[model samples]
Target: MASPAIHIPHGPARSAHLLQRTTAEWRERGEDLLLFAYGSLIWRPEFEYAEALPARVLGYHRALRMRSSVNRGSTHQPGLVLALLPGGSCRGLVYRVPRAIGEEALPQLWAREMPNGVYDPRWLHCDTPSGRLRALAFTLSRRSPNWTGPLHEPELLHIFRHAEGRYGTTLDYLLRTVQGLREHGIRDMELERQAHLAARHGLCAPP
Candidate 1:
């Protein structure tokens, strides 16, 4: 089946501008930085890191609640992506970036993550097996236009079944995230359940 055409947003320029301003502010502090990867970053960080460790973030849960209008779905038939929803905890990876390379890395990270400024990147406390740390995390601001709160099963399933975009199908993103989490010894019950349903119903797209 043919997917609907999508209008890619042009907010990446704004994101780049914000990155310059924000990273400069961060640089003023003169400290090492850490990034918490809960979704795609768990597998495709696309950046250099000095070290990585298993980490748990409190007070936020990973939800398949972001609307992807370009990468994983079209504007006409938007798909669901993972977002850091409030009220629970998430187990993921924390990447430590050395201060020497912070400038080069932060802008690149922002360009990838804040393309449309749908996320609010903030520093949140993390509990790692090694120790405690405050790490930068891209979280969904409920007020963002891309936030999809509390979708019904039928709608979500439909998205998983058909939505496709630049990256791939929605189902592929879901499956990959599940695989990435498992490799890190973390099993997200909600994602696992949804994945089971997807597999059982043959929601995956053809290669």
Candidate 2:
């Protein structure tokens, strides 16, 4: 069964405050900090973690509908990156960071994901093979200027063709995500379909 939709309210200081609050809470409890990852974090966590396991978060699903002009695209032509939007569920990986390392990781994570303070850092309950646990997950705020609710085919095609940023091209991001999911035994049909579309149109190589 599918999960219900969620409405996440955020303020100007939400991202910063939430990041600090969560880290402090974890430190106070003296437990491992868990992070729910459904995108690049699944493949390139770029942080040290004590453990990682297959996990699923309800009330949200992954979609490459978030506008990115930095890591995966540019100002002239934007690219799409994954965002955990309301509805359904998402299957990915949950990383467990030790208390000592989490302090160092939190700031770096905040810088990477909250460059514009667009994402809402939420504590979500994730179901894992081991058990259910609460983890920090970055979620999308539909009201954010960076949110690309939807895009026309032509606009998307243009992005796939010309969107390249400091990290890499939008096409590369899509293909890599598709590959990452497969590598983890997690299949996202929609992402796979998009990859095929990009390849068919010569926007990228075959997935």
Candidate 3:
């Protein structure tokens, strides 16, 4: 069988201008950049950070709502990835870039997260054990073409069973995120439910 082709949304990096502008603003203010990681970044940061701590952001919650044709699943049977959507709050990790590379890191971060231009990147206030912080968040608008709104359990199970992308299977993605959250003592009920569904149906092994 031919491998599934990766899906790259058109008009890549639509937020490049905004990211650059925000980076400049932060630089002008001499502020260190804080990168918020809720999904894959939780398990695999692939970046250097001075410190990391559990943090919570208001008015947005994490959902396996974004279609992934590259990192998590292929275009043929698109898998879901974590998306920060409006309403409620999300508990995740926040990383502070080493001061020397704080500014330099924004562009690299943008290239990784903004490739599909699916996220509306913003610096929102994060409440951490150490203190409150202004951390950058990748938010997906419901109106986006990539948004798969409110899929039921069976639909999600099918995706979990079949979806695979350049990186790996969707099951791994969900399991890894669940494990990361458990390790950090962050509870995401929706994600936990999804993992349970996957394991119960033999889509993945139980945690």
TM match of model 3 to true structure:
0.89
lDDT of each: 0.79, 0.83, 0.80
Where does model 2 exceed 4 Å of error?
Answer: 1-15
Q: What are the per-residue Cα lDDT tens digits for candidate 1 across 10-98?
A: 37755665566567656776877688899989988887888999999998889898998877889898987888876789999999988
Mind sharing the TM-score for model 1? 0.87
Model 1 has an lDDT value of: 0.79
Q: Which runs of model 1 end up more than 4 angstroms from their true locations?
A: 1-10, 205-207
Q: Give the Cα error of residue 154 in candidate 1, in Å.
A: 1.4
Which has the better TM-score: candidate 1, or candidate 2? 2
Report the poorest 10 consecutive residues by lDDT, candidate 1.
Answer: 1-10
Across residues 120-194, which tens digit of lDDT does each residue of candidate 3 receive? 777788999889888878888787888899999889988988888777888898899899888888778889898
Ranking by TM-score: 2, 3, 1
Q: Which stretches of candidate 3 lie over 4 Å from their true place?
A: 1-10, 13-15
Candidate 1 contains a number of clashing pairs equal to 0
